[model samples]
Target: MSAPTGKALEEVRAKAQADVRALRKRVDHLDNDAIDLILRQARSHYAWTDKPVTDEIIHELYEITAGGPTSMNTCPARFVFVRSQEGKERLAKSLKPANVPKVMGAPVSVIIAHDLNFWTELPFLFPHEDRRPHFEGKAEHAEVTAFRNGTLQGGYFMIAARALGLDVGPISGFSNEIADAEFFAGTSLKSNFLCNIGYADETALFQKLPRFAFDQVCSFA
Candidate 1:
């Protein structure tokens, strides 16, 4: 495949710009209830109920999450859903002892990883320009871009899961080396984080923790 020419790119951009207006006309913004459902009232679950996260739901969540923007649309995230007992057993070996039980109880645990060869897809994803040169064969550069954008996609994945009515528990309490060896052997992928997904057991929740106020963490530009 080839990159779009200047005129072709302009036309595509114009159509997308027009689409923004059309989309806003249908739903200008999400309401407070929607916001609360997706973010504010959402909790990171520690215990999960028996309800399973189905394949259809996983696909549905991905369809929405993949729409999230990444740097030059590199979209490097690679997800592995561990639902079987055998898969869970392998995954648990890499998780910290403290996180193992909760993760094991989850109906599904996803390994979010990034591909070092992500830029190879730039010709297809970011066809307006040949962006591959920025990362191709540049190991250090590719790794940074992959991890950064892949992590952004990970956040989108959690938000999408919440929006789809599944509770999420994201954790970095695991050994990356072990996880990579177990799941990504002989591959360019590197594990970023793990997220447990299922119907949460609300009773297991801890007291809400305080977050930094705007003034405490923000500053004027």
Candidate 2:
């Protein structure tokens, strides 16, 4: 199928918004299948099948991910979809032994990174007011906000991928220094974590692990 042109893209987006509104009119919450697709039944996959993650799906994933709200809409997250053999090799050099195979075997390995200079785009992202002054000269504050919000976007990214039928394997057991040097050289982007994205080899999966119950993890403030 042909990729949509500029106008076609706008039409597609409009149709999507309309569809959401129609669905909302029917029901306030998603069906169980959607809950399963987005979160409930999704698992962190370490082994992958041969199917490749196409560029179109990656683009759609980001479109959904970017829609998620952030503080002042800072939108600091930057993703590098490491797919080529050479790219995976470069990334593998930064990985621990166990994570190396996971990256190499997956069709796409994502470097979920953040831009320290993200505030420069506040004029475009948060144009309601001049928010740039709050972050411009404050290096420490900017870095903290970038990291916090960028991590939030990264979580949205993974959930979006899951919603789009891709398994995600998020891991932090890697060398940030090497990744920043290899993939983000001379850039403000700093590595947060890595994720293996692809169709999973379900046979290789371990039994589902237990999660903490609400009583164990939450309390009224």
Candidate 3:
């Protein structure tokens, strides 16, 4: 779509600012159904229907995910949407036997990865200070930061996909080495996880699993 300009851009920004102000005044939480759509009711779908996810939806998903916060705004996450049959085949050798079918059947499998040298872009993303020097020779620190923030972005990606009415199945049962060779070769990027996105086949869904109570998982300091 064409970029919104002049009065249109101003109106869009105004509406967004108004929404933020309105939310700050709200005390009530989201309704149960709305909550379920993004969290409680969303399932890790293993089976997919014949429906195809369009490129437009994928772009919209990124648009939403890109808004999520990252450490020092270092946004290290890089995505490879493996949609073609050839791409799936290339990925198959890296996946565990069990995850192979789920990935192959899905319309799209996303390779969620991080750039090892994400700090190099800090000048553009976090220009207030010279942050690149902090991580220039700190290889260990850079790797940890990249993995932590990139993994967080992956979570954002799933939430964004669900909000867009798509199901998500994130799996880590794969060889990182092989995946790096197949997808990130000749690059500083490294694989973190894989997520399959598509419409879920309800008939194949398992019963919702239970979760720990709030008290069981949290305590005041």
Predicted candidate 2: what Cα RMSD to the true structure? 5.9
Native RMSD of candidate 1 (Å):
1.5
| Candidate ranking (TM-score, best to worst) | 1, 3, 2
The best candidate in terms of TM-score: 1
**Candidate 2: Cα lDDT at 213:** 98
RMSD of each: 1.5, 5.9, 4.9
Candidate 2 worst ten-residue window by lDDT: 1-10
**For residues 35-98, could you state the per-residue lDDT of candidate 2 as single tens digits?**
9887888888889899978989999999999999999999999999999999999999999998
What range of 10 consecutive residues in model 1 has the weakest lDDT sum? 1-10
Model 1's TM-score against the true structure: 0.95
Residue 141 in candidate 3 has what lDDT? 95
TM-score of 3: 0.89
- TM for every model, in the order presented, reads 0.95, 0.88, 0.89
Per residue, candidate 1 scores C-alpha lDDT tens digits across 1-221 of 77657888799889999999999999999999989988887789999999878899999999999999998889999999999999999999998999999888999999999999988888899876888888767899999999999999999999999999999999899999999999999999999999999999999998878989999999998
Between the candidate structures 2 and 3, which one is better when assessed by lDDT?
3
lDDT of 3 at 103: 94
